[model samples]
Target: MPFEVREFPEFSWSFSRHKTLLTCARKYGYEYYASHNGWLYEADETAKHAYRLKKLTNVPLAFGQIVHELAEKAVRLFLKHGYVMTEAELIEEGRSMLNRAYLDSRDRKQLWMQKPARYKMLYDMYYKGELNRLEAEDYRGRLHVVFANLLNSRSFQDITTRPLSMQFQQAEEFRFMTVDGVKIFVVMDLLYRDLDAGKWVIVDWKTGKEAENDRSQLALYAYYIMQKYKARVEEIEIRNEYVLSGVNRTYQLMEEDIGLMLEKMKQSIHIMLRYQLDMISNEPVEMDEFPRTEYRQRCETCNHKEICLAQ
Candidate 1:
């Protein structure tokens, strides 16, 4: 395969899209292709009803979003100004935010949350200190730890002092030109130049647990920068700060990795193009082509289980 690193491509390949396709083609079809039944006004009654549930998230996903927002705020403050919120402050604010989400979800739980109403119930139980013995103990216990881990990290400390020539902080999805005419979309949490190392650095703060797919995520960011920028960057260093464990995994990219990453992108892009075309033509993808997971246990926790009938 001829690897051509050029200017950024138009909006196309996103991490979520690829992940969805890999996880379940039917889910991907329901999401991206069908726009999660987003036609709304034009959508049939069934589609309109299904679209609402498509976006409903469970506790873990909601909790992760909350953490990401908090971390973004804390990190932005330290970067723009030399201020770090104390651990206590972080915990207090986290609890407060959790409370707010609970109230909001609870008020509207009838419309969205199912019987037992986990969304509203989660906050209600946590305040009552029930998670201490429940299966949710891990999330509650590690809740405030991410603040300390992120604030104390070497790179984070340096971010407070060392100014970069250029930086993109959790900016909107980056869209650019691709040689193959396959557009790519990715939201970079952070990308900046390191004057000392002369390497562009990308940081993606991960929560909860680390997954093997993280490696490719960082690699894709580097691939985007390399293709987008005209400057002759020696290398791009990517960092994954798994806040829950205070683990910082860094990867430096050279020609070897970039070449390999491009190959991977090619495969993903090809599938994406076909899937997109199928959707655009209003062609129904064969259900067997995107079968449910063999692991029935996974469906127990999947948000789409009800809609997909995975079991």
Candidate 2:
């Protein structure tokens, strides 16, 4: 076969991407630009390093990811296999996953360093040399609360108990919709039609404390559902299921909210476009064009700190 060149990374927008750009321009460059083709053997060292660091996850994020995975698994099992995972089962499964990840991060340092994409690398382990024992146990202990809350959550109960035939979208499925010729990426935790209420519901499983931007993120998901599913704003209900805290907050989207979100997205895209040397190719300008954040605290926790601080 003839050699085929790799395609350049496509420019896309997501809530996380927008937040990253707002957080620090330099970190955004490392994540979206510098790490583009770092998997190739001939790639420069900086690109390779940035790519590896980008894959690093801390304790909180890893914990949240595990919860999300289990939540998806539970939903699929009930909907497809007619089996519901009990609280005990969920806790056991979560513990097993956590143990395996901890071992991978602790014992497989060499493998992770060589191919970070294929293995887990805890930020605490990489930078601090070890995870604090108390912190690890704390997360482990919270597994019970998390799983219990998940089982008792209003959304979870509603989803599993309702007819499996209800129109629903699976969790963790990467999906996108175009707005004004720009691709907007969205991944919903769960979405289903509430047959009783005659409403389409969008559920976001939150494993962390509620943040100010949580509603905005859900609004974006609501927009995706509205556009692709052709549901009206009046007929849709958005929910933030805070599993850790056992709180479920619901919001009704307005046409005006979506309008504002679109405007915000457009402005963010315009700002990002300014840094591109070639818009068609998504090629970024000089590294310096993306300035480092003045906040030292952000740098302290940044994934690209190794290379970013060096510069």
Candidate 3:
């Protein structure tokens, strides 16, 4: 007897278009789907610590809390002094915040490991240089535009707008399926309304040099959003903020482009279905000629990198 292959509808909705595709299709099949790669949310250790401490009986969130506090302070100081905050000052504030948290009687060494000095040093590097560099050079002149979308009172906004009100550390998960009946779950960094256009915008934040060939990810995401909500999607935006370099770039989705991508997604899914059918029928796998993908420095940080190897 054979087990049944799982399949589900693709009409689900989500702020995260990326996850929806991933959840719905085979990972390799959806490799070209819109991608959200970056360090803004992934780099901050403080938020990770803070989230962990939620059930730790007051063990205080570590790096992210301190970093946010320090960053808020740094932003304030930047506003007042009209100068860049030095790396050392940010580190000092972060250290002080960490110390205050660690020394709290309720937080001492009970549920958490003492943060290593190296971690603090790494975070300082991320803040003082990496994040700053990207923001200054690549992402210059878009702060207000980005902030407006992030700070909206609405539940969903684009990455550019939402980061202003909430730190990149926060994310929302959305689930939907493709037309071919595959369930997907995307943990979106941000979603927003394009007020001027009266349309919903979906976003994914990126941290490095934007990939010219990665529009597929965005396109698939946009198609899913349109399919799920039955709303006119004005645009799909991807905010690539180079945390290490501090550079930012925004990509907007066009109508024709999305249409082409939707077609591509359907083709890919059918190809994947064939692969699944072949596996079930005990057919020999016709592997790709050059099977191995080159390693990317970013791969070290990818959640799916380990699984990629097995594939």
Candidate 4:
């Protein structure tokens, strides 16, 4: 058989992608366009470097990911085997995962450079060459708090104590829906049928403090849920489970809320399309067409700063 020729993935819209575009157009280009096919052995050095930088993670992001993973693990255990991981077990596993990442970034530079997709290269270590000991300890403490809060979270209790039959959708699953002919991606942390409330509950696990965009993000998820599940505004319940603080904030979304979210998405897509060379082909223009942000401070923490700043 002949070797298969690979093509770049089609462009797609997502909440995170929209945010990235807003944050820095150049970064958006590198992440979604320039890095395309960077995995190919014959790819350019610039594309390869950008792709490696794109995979860089920091302490906060890594912490949130680990917590989400553990949360998914807990849901799977209870759903599949009628078991929930103990708090001690959750903390132990979280710490171990974090430690491995830390060690990888600290000691496995050659390995990470060789296989950035498989190995973790933390942003802090990559740029600063070392992490502050005090900060590392603080994140470890935060990890413990997140797991403890997760166990005590209302969403977790509802998931574990409620009937397994009430579960409506899989946790942490990649799902998408189309609006105005544009594909929108959504990954619900936890979604279930609330028999008592006669509604579908969408839980978003938060490992860090709340941000202004949290409600809007959930609103977008609600839009997808409504479209895909044929759920009405009243039939859907939105929740932000801030595991770090053990706060479960529920938002009562109206049809108007989802409508606004759709409009925002449309506007965002329109802006992004301006930077593309061919909307049909999802092709991006020259690198210089996507300008870097005027704000210099943001670049300090940007993953693509190495290649970006070199310009």
What's the lDDT for all of these models?
Answer: 0.63, 0.87, 0.40, 0.86
Per-residue alpha-carbon lDDT of model 1 for 110-198, expressed as tens digits?
54433222344343333342333353455556677877887776567657656554454455644554647666666776667777777
Candidate 2: RMSD over Cα atoms? 2.2
Model 2 Cα lDDT, one tens digit per residue, 34-117: 887787778778778889999999878889999999999998888888798999999999999888778889999888877888
By TM-score, the candidates rank as 4, 2, 1, 3
Using TM-score as the yardstick, the better of models 1 and 2 is: 2
TM-score of 4: 0.95
lDDT assessment of candidate 2:
0.87
The CA lDDT at 63 in model 2 is 91
**Worst lDDT window (10 residues) for model 4?**
164-173
Relative to the unseen true structure, what is the C-alpha lDDT of residue 213 in candidate 3, on a scale of 0 to 100?
41
Error of 1 at 245 (Å): 1.2
Q: TM-score for every candidate vs. truth?
A: 0.78, 0.94, 0.39, 0.95
User: Model 3, residue 304: displacement in angstroms?
Assistant: 12
User: Order the candidates by lDDT, highest first — what do you get?
Assistant: 2, 4, 1, 3
Residue 17 shift from truth in candidate 2, angstroms = 0.7
Which 10 consecutive residues of model 2 have the lowest summed lDDT?
164-173
Better of 2 and 3 by lDDT: 2
